[model samples]
Target: MTQARRNGVLSDATFDDVRRDAWPVVLLPFGATEPHNTHLPYGTDTILGSEVAARVAAHCMAAGTNVMALPAVPFGVNTTQLDLPFTINVMPSTQLALLRDVIRSLEPHGVRALVLLNAHGGNELRALVRELQPSTPIMLAIVNWWQAADHATFEQAGDHAGELETAAIMHVAPHLVAPDRHTWGDGRSNPSTLEGVRRGVAWMPRRWTQATVDTGVGDPRAATAENGAAFVAQAVERITAFCCELAVADPSSLWAPAP
Candidate 1:
């Protein structure tokens, strides 16, 4: 009935008379299934990823970009949180294989590219993308939201499960946020000093137990639903603009400046 479908903003929701080359951009919300301290839900990654992705889709509609938002890939790199009760982790290889299949499916269509709105911090997915570059003609760009849109605000908040995340949960899914359990630890200071942030220069791995030690990071007391709304909205706006720009770019021109 409409010009936009579910995950791929350019799809036809009716699925009737669907043409092979009718879609636009294919957006993916990749997230993790891990704990966010004691207050946030295990679905935090999915919630944030999907919500942000949806916001981007909406923005694209306003921007006149025929992009669609896809359902989120809930399980991310949670190897550290594997020890936690409900957390699950997907291997990088598995993610790569899955992405390859999905990309292949969209390559023949009008889906010009893919925008990965990522919520997890694990960088393994970056490597996975590189592996898929050859077979997948679709341009893929990964936007680690926290890094892409809100790094400044996050560093100001100190750590996770702190102000930023608490506010985000409160704004997106208040029911999942335990207002009473919202607390902070003083061990990892704001912008955690290089010493507190480093495990090993070359390689480092943190056990899930170590994560709970800090539960959530940042200053939850400082978090407010208002800030979350503002930040999430900004992220969506930026993500949409980024996607639109990529949607029309010359694929071979990535080697040079946009100008």
Candidate 2:
């Protein structure tokens, strides 16, 4: 096998090899272009999503799984955060349309499965998957990388630009992170006025400005590159295992028969 085939990156693979190899499964790393506080770059989610997907794809190939990683989608539903400067929000309908096209394009190439590896909190894609799965021939699955891990190492995993993300960026692309700790936001978030919402029963979108003072939801002062590496390693391992299984799964009968 060639290096690109072994790596299992669609962009890096040559057309000849892609036609010859016919990878059955593809991983689409979906992320958002949004702010991650003052310390982290706007592409934090996309960077992490793409990085994690690439790593997982490489590992899957090593494990003899026919898998490929597509280039990351660097935008997502950011309706609440649109007020924040430079935050791009793609309507859910638009996102679905784009996803539908990608799925349709993969059908003729013998791709049987597509895993949507979502990295951003805002891009809730399960509903979209549910809507698309019945209409398409290919199998669809979504994996939220952050939620896959236990995340017990950090004091606060944070909803937006918090300890987990700060550490992750520090690990993946240290240069993108601001060096001065003094420049980092404390990531303080205000509580919702609704009692049910506070207790997790009711739900409502938070106004970005009103939710947090500095566009952060968790304290990132204590984040370390070491912790981030460990967290990402754990997540990658788990996600890779799942992809390997999915790659080899019989699509017509994915679930086991009952006793």
Candidate 3:
């Protein structure tokens, strides 16, 4: 079952359903199309972003919240990874424009809330939100799904194609994971830039080629599907609670000087 009408999945929902129901908030899944080391699929970020949004949206719908899951934006800002093969890059300006158009589309439909469930580290939507806030009545939120919670469920929560991602893919789509053919990641860092970044004294995009030959940032040796399942379940629980709150929050009082 697509769970279209039940969950308010935009692509799956019919035009009539969308027109009939007043959705309180729409989830915009932002992801990246890039290399996640040599072992993981290129669509790792997309898969994570879309799946998290879908799952949370489903939960909210089951709880009778007016939440809708928009279609996943599969391309993200991958300027640093442009040299890598087939790493589709969308500049920050393009991202802002894309967000503007999406927001514009939602305005006519009476949807005033948008939650950006971002799965890619390279794609940051905060700046876009700051720029577009004054222009619209929409309440925008940018959530980095991977960092939404402390994933202590895993023994090692590797950043890139490390334990965390590998385990996540295992639980979400085990058929796509090939651990047998996987190369272990070490979370290597460039000596020239690593210290500066660690000290917070300088900032620069780390080239994948310069970071590691495999483009991996963490070790996946300790990753397990069981751990992934726990992590994902926790994330869903946390995000669902937030969504439920957003569903009923008064738009006028969202920012009242934080008294």
Candidate 4:
């Protein structure tokens, strides 16, 4: 256990340090490789997920919590965006299989919990977690990092390559963002004709090409690094707190007592 150099990042930790350290909870940042309008890079989700997970893990380690951040899974359910160039889509079944293997690998290492720090909105994983929880000894949990924080700061946090995401990328990796704002796309989506779908009474994946002009669902013109930093900080604080509590929680009695 190299406490002096510990950062709770599994990729950076040495084998000797890992074998000796007590990792009660491990965070797996899951993201997708896809387009984020014309300004942000294709790897925005992956980068954001990895960065947030790393920050949370570092905070946890600093606070003496036994938590580890795993390397992010860079591909996600991009079924609707497959028509777009270079967009990679991993089927739900494949995701389940991959996650199962990850859990199996951790079981022998004495890991007691697994937190899926999901960054991609398309990765519908709640059902997957429910399906796997009963059979696995490792406690399963998921957190959509975007929804982890309040969005009162931004005017409109678009669904995709929009204000919130663009701001976030600007904060984390400014180099990846295109400096020429003129080339940026206005993330306006074409709403469905069906009233049910438009009103959230029904559900269906929007066709990327038909949904928006450039795959963006929100406006990114007002995005600023300052706002992004503030949002990310809030998310990190909330998530770190949750991870810390989960690390020491009794799995058998996770629910609250009779009220």
Candidate 5:
């Protein structure tokens, strides 16, 4: 059964009782409502993120562990998609507030730590993480599911709607992909790292209009289900490992620096 996939069934008899074999851990799919090229669905990001969360939760549970995967949070900070129609851009503060509220709401109910399975590249969650550290004092952390897979196996590094994402989408939801959009589109046009791929490097945002014109970055044609399977396997393994690690970590210890 899906961890927290709530049906109309009575709440008391569901997850809290039926799935008592494991500890209460939440796997959240934080996604964005934005454009994902012509071929891909607007919910592609969350779809993948939710897929990862579900698979990872299953893996963890099978290993004699307890975990619950919550339904995905589909709306995120999609400022990059602002110009596009139907692109809902929630403010950072709003996102943070929502997260904080969720954390607080979930904490008292035995939901210890959270695995933030995020998908949107536009959402800047690092600052939100910092802000929540002191308030909730839970074992909270972020995990961008798209980046959890091994890049070497991907045959394409991380980028928007590029090789990795395309392959992943193809793997998870092949029927949703538009073949014409995949075949007709030009090669990935955007430089995902306009400011360079270094911390504190010269910063310049790549405007979606000019940089991501086709609404994609990497080569989608290069994608395949095989690559997506590998990515999913690796991501599930990695995400499960992270979930296990975070399960035992103390929130106070987060402040300590490693040498």
Candidate 6:
């Protein structure tokens, strides 16, 4: 079994062991099955999400915080990239239903918080969370791992299959990355779309084909394992800190004014 299997991972732990914990925080890694340019694997998002969750869970457990890292949900909202041959897309409504059910299961199990460790850009859950919050008893949070750290940390803040992702996969799963076949992407954007997003005034789903010819948004030629290692370390540290706080937070007063 893998180290991830031994450390309070839900897929690896028995029901008896899981039930013994008073109120563990559950980490659900969410990813998508889509092409990651010519170099990275289709499962890059899933692999990265799962790896981050496992690391955070192991860190929290060793610190005396009960945490369970669930296996990554390999399918996410990939509607934009459906044109890609092997991309698997799940509708936004489908994702919401899946999450609602997942959350329902954890509440009765004494789970305090359900953190969605999201890895794909297309899997936005804030709207679903808003709709579900009033109905559910458990506290839910979403963490876009890439957004947790400062973009200035890397030479380039890539959009997709770029230096940022390439470097991360290199460190997290080096064997799966083929840097030798690196490609270039300028991470282009329609000026109007960029401006609207920056102003928080407009929004629309991007057509992947129109975005880039290679299905990539950033340049990967300069990506290196060292760069990946540093970025992943920073991201893990930030995520682990958030999980630690979630573990001890009281659901009743989670949003109540501090004394």
The most accurate candidate by lDDT is 4
TM-score each candidate. Answer: 0.84, 0.95, 0.92, 0.96, 0.84, 0.90
Model 2, residue 222: distance off in Å is 1.4
Residue-by-residue lDDT tens digits, candidate 1, 22-76: 5467688898777676677888877888878777877776777667777788888
> Which ranges of candidate 4 are over 4 A from the true structure?
1-6
Task: Specify the poorest-scoring 10-residue window by lDDT in model 2.
Answer: 1-10
Ranked by lDDT from best down, the candidates are 4, 2, 3, 6, 5, 1
- Backbone clashes in model 6, listed as residue pairs: 167-228
- Clash numbers, per candidate: 9, 0, 1, 0, 1, 1
> Tens-digit lDDT track for model 5 on 111-177?
6687788888877788988989777756777888877767887566547777778788889999988
Question: Which should have the higher lDDT, number 1 or number 4?
Answer: 4
**Residue by residue across 175-197, what tens digits does model 2's lDDT show?**
99999999999999999999999
Q: What's the alpha carbon RMSD for model 5?
A: 4.1
| Candidate 4 lDDT over residue span 1-259, tens digit each | 7536547888888988788888999999999999899999989999999999999998888898978999999999999888899999999999999999999999998888899999999999998898899999999999999999989879998889899999899999999999999899988889998899989999998888998998899999899999999999999999999998888888889888698
Candidate achieving higher TM-score, 5 or 6: 6
lDDT of each: 0.70, 0.89, 0.84, 0.92, 0.74, 0.82
Point out where model 5 deviates above 4 Å.
1-22, 181-184, 190-200, 252-259
Q: Any runs in candidate 2 off by more than 4 Å, and if so which? A: 1-6, 257-259
lDDT per residue (tens digit) for residues 78-133 in model 6: 88778889899999899899989998887777787889999999998898889888
Clashing pairs in 2: none
TM-score, model 4 to reference: 0.96
Q: Say which prediction, candidate 2 or candidate 6, comes out ahead on TM-score.
A: 2
